[model samples]
Target chain A: MSIRARIDALFPRLASEQQFPTQGQTIFVDLERQEVRRAWIPHRVVTQLLGGRGVNMFLLHNLLDEALEPIHPEVPLIFGTGILTSMVPSASRGNVTSWSPESRVLMDSNAGDYFPSFMKLNGIDHLVLYGKAPKWTLLHFEGDQPKFVDAAPFMGLDNIDLRAKIANDFSGVEGKDYGLAAITTAGENLVLCSGIMAGPKAIYARGGPGAKMGALNLKAVLIQGRSADLSTARPHKLRNRDVAVKLLNTSVVKNALKKRGTPFLYKPSRMLGAMGTKNNQETTWTDKLDAENIDPYRPGMEGCFACPVNCRPLNDMSVLGESGVGSRESETPAVDHVAATPDTRQPTPIPDKYVKGDGPEYVTLGKFGPNVGITEVTQVLRLNNICNDLGLDTASTGSAISWAMELYQRGMITREQTQIDLEWGNYETIERLLFMTAKREGFGDVIADSSQAVATGKYPRESLDYLMAVKGLTQSDPHDARILKAFALGLAVATRGMDHLRNRVTLEINAKINDSPDFKAELYGGPVSAEPNSYEGKETAVRRCENIYAVGDSVGMCRFTTKLFNSPSLPGYEEFADQVANVTGIELTNEAIDHIGLNVMGVERLINAKLGITRADDTLPKRWFEEAIGVGPYKGEKIDRGEFDKMLSRFYAISNLTEEGVPKPEWREELEGVLTA
Target chain B: MLQTESRVTVRLPEPLREGRGDVITMNATSLGDIIAELDLADDRDELFNFAVNGDLVLHGEKDVALKYGDEVEIVVAFAGG
Candidate 1:
């Protein structure tokens, strides 16, 4: 049957009281028309897509114009719920999409729990918002209608307070649970680095979606549904839910993430000299590892929604307060310490009592710590809290700060002229600057615009050469490019600029080998191991990983669990295709799924191209090639431009791009065809 | 003839214990010679700044003579911001 016919048939059947189950209901609000419309997306489609990430991406690519810049007001903002969100057991991952302010590219960030399942119960496969609301308005979905309520009271509220207020207001609602995904003061102010917060702790914090929303004057998107029919799937469909539960409960998938979160992987990465430190100047910080209390292994495990793998850590902040340490996560403290304490002779010991909380993930630490040279645990916490409250992305904030510090160090700006004293390890100046950047105060205002912009006149253009970013997004995880060429290439070509999440080639390669002879061969370049330093098969490896990630994102599944758990084989695809076939009744093939991934990537590339991005935006910081650290596994090593160029050529070849690295006209035509059709 | 060997006591951070054996002792004519003999990774060097007795050693000028029982501390540099 045609997709349109299938959807038409299912919508009526699911919407009608006779055929519709009691657990679900449809609520529709048309803001522009000031009318209410309602419909249901079949449970079959939800099951097939496996919820949030997968379904959302599919809708987004279809709804938004691929050629438009990610930040354009015309770009659509999509909120989607996953198949197993509330019903099946495991972490519940919610997905959001927008043009990323940080990367200046297309991107999405995930939130945990309530939001996904709650939306699903309301009979929404996805919430698609296009164009800007005329004014600040609160979108409230209840029963079969969406109420456009006044949002003036909630306007300007920070994420934490906003969530508290929403929960308080909706406290009386029973099984009809709800959650708020809103922007903070920084986002409302349209700060370039702002992010959207979901609930108290979970945040869709990357890519500056908050800033995008603020620009459009979108106050908050509140998803609340009381329909009990959401859990009432058909008896036969219950079998699929059981399969999902078994898959999640199985030992293989949950063990890895549960052990030490994803941060544990850093041990091997560090040993291989692939860990990032101080904006990629140093690959490892062995001594600081203990002082900064950067442990891959820790106690307590938390998760999102029905996800069984509890990867989030519940941190203790009491010790941190006692030690005069404001922040107690892993990365921020490390970044602050390394950047501030440049001269090693007076090695300062971070007080053990000050170590508070759990993660400063690899990216957070790399950006916040060595990158900007401040080492106080308190200072990192302050920065983290400030960023959260201000609605700025911690990664971008750290990157920008590091860039400013380097510019100052290089004589690009005098200490007095820069306004803030950027001496390494000084908490006072760093603290002042964090708020300043959020408020666009003084030099902070100029720096918050972007590293590229700051590097323009604040520092000599040559000094900008040291920034390790692609487009405007800073590179996360300080792995040496020479050691992990595939990762470097992936970062360079990432759709949302330089990020580790989008194309995790390094982790994928590591997982594939898995303590076997095969692993050795891949790493060492022999039957035993492939040489990590060699770029020989890196392009192919990166391309495969990128494609898989894109597919996962478009399918609306959590990459953390889905990609890692179902490696080598994507178990859910057949079911996923079946679900799409049943709902839209479009017989989607595995090949079609692959096509969606590629198509999304192509669209992302088009978006960048429209923004006038070229090969220049794909390059890394020049310091990686020029500065050779005096010690460590990579002591004498540095990236050579010629070799990088060769690698880029190979990468372009795999993507079927022209020699100059532009997507081939034929490929573009093919993508355009798919889009139009 | 062996010049007076510096009795440098290297303190290992708790986290690095797994990588390097808990404690190591080495003899060298100068601090540079000791560093060369130890064959530590560059990341380790970035982590700790060496102090002889209580004075900081400047890079490149490795001529500080090591005397018997001369205390050397390998202090780990903190990076938390």
Candidate 2:
């Protein structure tokens, strides 16, 4: 028999018990009742939707009430781990899904760290929270029993302090014995731009899930499982070492990532003339904010569970000479690494201000640095640590500040409203705004809802025009997308609004790869797709990448571990299929995996369609079409309205959606079968 | 003769600037020639892209003839979000 035939023969029955690789149980938390229960996840749900964002989409579609507000007690918040989440390398991701308080649409946010893995190991593959709690509550899952604790003491604390307090009050070591997902005062205050801190540094920062958690009065969800015997606990074997070797050997970018973390992308973005400066009024900036400039303050690196890339850079508060946000209670920073010596050298004296945190990732750096017109790398790092401590989404916060600065420049707002001079690159004002927004103070409360929300009747129509948002969520990744048509198309059609992680085709910028017409034709459907400026084949590229990214998210694999984002050499459909087979003992062809991804998109579309999304909603911000890059190599680059419309139409066609941008009857029917199965 | 007389001003990112400095005044006829002259450890074809006079030069445009005083930027080929 053929290898495929043999594999199929081995799992021909697909016993219902084998469907769920992790405990196969979904924890149902009823906050209003202050009760918790467990249910077996249907085998059909596992087989059809896979897991993580895919299953989250299914749950959202079934449980969501279209008539109610996003924060309504009836609206459910679902958390899911991917089918392969803890079984493979770089597969340490989880998804939290709900109606977005920020965008007023279905929102699914993902984060990578030990939290997801720990949740699975503690016998929870899925969690669904229903109803609002009577008061602040903590859901604790230890062993098999799930219980609720009065979280009154944990309320109002930042994530940094929350974790420290949890350790003090709870029983168990943080990472080894347990893992947590918590919110800070930002979430507690229901700051629409707030995010949930996953473990120490990773965050589910998009779509206002943090605010939703706050609205539900859920302070934290802690899972405890110290000694999970993997040999008996899980059926699949972990191919971590083998996968790590394959990743490092195949992807050239992994080495650079290992060395400098994500800050390494700064130089390349600057070189492309795509780095957005001054709220994208300019596309380039001075080299003072470059990666090398930021290197001095980067003390070390960190990574998600089982991920070899370790792409998270550590910001050294000692080097930057500012005490980090959470270290306010004591003289020396509370972090352990800041005190430890590197190499044989004596440890440098802990500066008067000392703290340690992960990243100022590239997206954080760009949004906080040039996009807001801040040039100092130290200032950017400071802002990053502050945002991390406060549980604020750095991208949206920076965009909010930048939009205000532009409004200030245009004389739309004054000092009477803002209190502080909203000048470009005003470090003090920018820093102060983050604190205020987290606390919901004064003008900060206005901008905290999002740049789009601030522009109701309060600001002029031109102020709304200056707002760089799509579908209400402000733009992340400060790269000027107009220069790359595929990326531009992605921003318009992303399910979660103006986020780049949805469908950024980084391959568009790689010139050498674009040289091969055959490769372009095979991957993106036409030779013209290789050209960054060309609109002809861009729709196809975006459609393909959207599917790839959807699949990556569904599987809990980081985009960095796949060819979708940067490394063309990393795993794609064929490799993912192999991993799935090894993990589940179920055979899934590359085409079947691709269909699963397409179906995942269909479910998301159904939810959005229920929320009333039209073709008009799938579009770029007006600024992208009206203004060209004012300076840099990409000067004069702007999206042509006619071409963009054509691209949108083509994208809809390729995605099996109507010109209205909603999934067609046939596609919806097909998805319905999988969802109901 | 004009190609030899042409003095292209080439700008380099920090990694390539070691020993050679940040900017270089080089006598090269084309983008490929300038790349060939640089002391690079990685394959120039795969590792870098070039820009002339502040415009990104695409794949097929590398052979575009260079003129005197043209400013060239050597960009490392990388992408991320």
Candidate 3:
């Protein structure tokens, strides 16, 4: 078959439907040459590498001709969706793919928002960009046709203002008619912590994709209009989505999310005495920062597109609405707003203009709450509000700030260098630093860089002691690795640097309730080989979770609902295969699904190898091994290096990679052949 | 299959309340007793970790002895946000 013919065949759709199942026409635009060429990814690519991060990896590997920085003009910026996104439940995911200016590796960041469904509904599943814009531009999509409008007016605007100005321009169209992605000034300044915003809330908030867009001088991708010729799909595949919907309706655990938001993490982690506080140095906190504390402010429960579970807490942060700099069009907005904003909400004395807020999820709570020693729930909301406006990633920003706070306490970074009398848990100082960091002013400029770079520049060698990072990225998920052994292992081996989204072992030595041999065999497909504290069976558990998560990311499904081992009713690899087969007319058995995941994994390993990542990089931070958690039930707890090595070796063996974390020649050859694009 | 005549106040988070109320007075001595008393026995998903006065009952049944007025917080287990 011809490449286009193969691409057509891969996405099987309903004959009754007039549109392509993959949605959107494929086109490549070179900004420098001002050329827009029609292009299509042979469906063979999706079959070989799957979609989302997997497909992104394969395409980027083949496209890059020379070793250029992520912000280099020659690099391509790619946006992709999974085969199942907008076709199935909770698949409201859109991914941005590029070499990360932060980690300097080909990376993809996924966000759940209205924007992705707009792409799917509009038939623009895959969009690619090249060269640098001669002038700032906004790529507006009406179906597949894009008009590159001058974006000079939108330049230097915060994420919220950019979204609002554009949304207001098209306000007559209604809220659901369009989806937009834009950047803040931080991205324009090339701040390593910057991210791409989708809608006013959801963010592709990791790996500095914003910096790449900023370098392109591309302001936005505004997608509007439905596919006049809608993509068709086999009704049988879509009918299978009922399985997920029914499961969602009946599941008991899904209710927890609906009721409490991600704040559910607070109660359990606190009960185990394993919550993050004052960075990783402490993992316990006072009861005031508990998940339940948000009760007064949490008004409504919201959800992503097509999802039944409304897991996000809609907070009436109107008090905080005026607290942001987004309201002002030009110049620094916060210094004025900070003084002008006032609190009408009483009891806790939270200051105003930062309200009408959306989230203070677990990461926000942990990072801004316990991690920084602020027990006040409202202050965390302030942090969330600030980060959301300035286009900063809450996880990394929190980690970076907390890491610095730890340094200051130990007398490593004094006030002379920091320009603030930095102290642990000082909410006022913490809030001040957030503004400065976002603006890249004063000491904030030093911190806007990677924590490792900051440590190298400002602190002594011993200062690396408490920096909980892997592969130069700060640890975002606030879990202390010493307590959640498998999570720690996931951070080390995951393709993304220091991320837990790739894999999480729900059952582990730490949570050893499922230790029976029969039960282990039933769930894990193996014998009860190791205890929670032992290194024996952890590798098997982590590898299994990673592949399932890999498939979830590729399909654009939410992993919280799909692969959760904590639940009695998680959709497994078999279910994933069934959905893929039903939706795309691709018949994938359980083995094929596993193979696809492995194929994706192998490609990432190859890419990382090409980027010079090694087995040593596939290791945890010194904090996990050297410093025992100072407080908590798991006090004086640290990972055993010997045990960690055993687990790492097991992981390498499973991935078909060498001990040095590089894919073996045969493995590379197999992946290379799979990259038929 | 032990005699259960003890009384305990089991506090349920909103998700598990079945629209009754957050606080429930049930006859229970052990974790199994609480599960059975709530009539959650047949549908017992073991969905939560039992905590008595902020410490987890690592062992499920009767691991931590219940006392009068001791607040039991049922926490749902999750990996990340």
Q: Estimate, for each residue in A1-677, the C-alpha lDDT of model 1 and write its tens digit.
A: 32232233434433343223322333333344444445544443333333355545444444455455555556667676554445444425557776565565566776664566566555665665555567777777664356777788888676556766777876733223675667877777666666777644466766777777766567777767655454342333554465465455533344334544444343334444555655565665543433235332233666655555566643444432332233322213343322332221223334432234434444454555555665543455445544555566777777777667766776777878776677655555666676666666677776666654553355566766777677777765544564556667777777777776666554323322322445434432333223445566667666666765665554445565443222432234454455434433345686666555555566667656665677777776677668764444445666678887887887788777777556689987775544333
Q: What is the interface RMSD of candidate 1, in Å?
A: 14.9
Q: State the lDDT of candidate 2 residue by residue for A1-677, as single tens digits.
A: 32123223423223334343443466667788876655655666555567788888876776677888887766878888876787788888989999998888768888987788787676667788877889889888786467788999988888777888988888666767787898899898888888888877788889887889998889998888743333333233455566767677653444456767677667667766788778888788777877777777778888887787787888886754444332221333233322221111223333322156778788888988888887777667777877888888888888888888888888889989787778887665676688788888877887777754553455666677888888888888888888889889999999988888888877777666676668666776555555678897888778878888888888888877776566566777776677766665556777777777777878888898889887888888898999887666567889999999998998888889888887799877877765543
DockQ, candidate 1, comes to 0.03
TM-score of 3: 0.89
- After TM-score superposition, what is the CA distance of residue A323 in candidate 2 from its true location, in Å? 6.2
Stretches > 4 Å off in candidate 1:
A1-72, A81-91, A172-176, A226-256, A265-272, A286-299, A319-359, A376-382, A455-463, A478-480, A508-529, A564-592, A656-670, B1-81
Model 3 chain B: weakest 10-residue lDDT segment is B38-47
How well docked is model 2, in DockQ terms?
Answer: 0.35
Q: Which stretches of candidate 3 lie over 4 Å from their true place?
A: A1-20, A23-25, A171-175, A236-241, A250-253, A318-352, A455-462, A507-517, A528-531, A565-568, B1-9, B18-30, B39-46, B57-71
**Chain B alone vs. reference chain B, TM-score for every model:** 0.58, 0.78, 0.69
Q: Residue A494's C-alpha lDDT in candidate 2?
A: 91
- Comparing 1 and 3 on DockQ, the stronger one: 3
Q: In terms of lDDT, which candidate is strongest?
A: 2
Question: What order do you get sorting by lDDT, best first?
Answer: 2, 3, 1
Give the per-residue lDDT digits (tens) of candidate 3, residues B1-81: 222345567788667788868887766666766755665543323456667767654433333467556667666656555
Clashing pairs in 2: none
For model 3, residues A1-677, the per-residue Cα lDDT tens digits are: 32223323433321223222553444566766666655445555667656766777766666653366667866777787776777677777868877777777656788877777777777666666777889989888776678888888888788666777887776633227887888888777767777888756678877777778888888788888776344445564455566566557543346567777777677677766778778777777877777787777788887777777777786665544333222111122233224434432333334454665778778778888888887667667767877787888888788878888888898888888887767877666666676677667887776677554443475677766677777766776787778666677888998768887777776552122443456555565455353444466667777777887788777777766765445536666766677676666667777778777777777877777777788898888886788787754556778989888988998888778888977788877777876642
